[model samples]
Target: MDDKKVKILLGKRIKQLRQSFNFTQFVLGEKIDINQRQVAQIESGHSFPSLSTLVKLAKVYNCEIKDLFNYNHLEKEEKVKENIINIISNLDKKDAQLLYAIVKVIREK
Candidate 1:
């Protein structure tokens, strides 16, 4: 993926997971020892986090670091196939290709 796409993907995933646990930017920042603004930037895809910050976030959120990024592409695809075939069928070729690649990597693990 391109740099912009990667950033957006990571940011969206972080935001999704953070909200899933009912965490505010301030609360998550406090747990990770960063300011809320930094958390905002992370979730907004305006900045990239250092490895240490990523680790801290993973720890604070009680998730493995792998959960912070786009590792769920495969799982999402499966869910779509099982539960949302129309949505999956609507995806363009590029998206399907990307999903296929992610599924391949996930299966390898």
Candidate 2:
């Protein structure tokens, strides 16, 4: 998969996991020292997170680093992809393109 796809998938997983743990954006963001808006941005797949931030998130969620990016079941993968697409579909074209560009860069690396 491409980087954009990765970002979106990561975001979807993060959001779902966060919700599963009954965490609001403010609650999760506080642990990482970011505002709720930032958390929302990350969960919405509008922005990528730094490594340290990702570590903190994984720690807070009680999940391994690999868990944050993994989709083992085909149904789960499709659901997350659908969620990511839904989130991005509402954004303006520029924002969507920016996300896609990030994914492209990641894919190249």
* Backbone clashes in model 1, listed as residue pairs: none
Worst 10 residues of 2 by lDDT: 68-77
TM-score, cand. 2 vs. native: 0.65
Show model 1 residue runs off by greater than 4 Å: 71-109
Q: Residue by residue across 37-94, what tens digits does model 2's lDDT show?
A: 9888888778889999989988998888888887456347688889998999898989
* lDDT of model 2 at position 84: 96
Candidate that scores best on TM-score? 2
Against the true structure, candidate 1 reaches a TM-score of 0.62
| C-alpha-based local distance difference test score of model 2 | 0.85
- Off-target runs (Cα >4 Å) in candidate 2 are 74-109
Give Cα-based local distance difference scores for all models: 0.81, 0.85
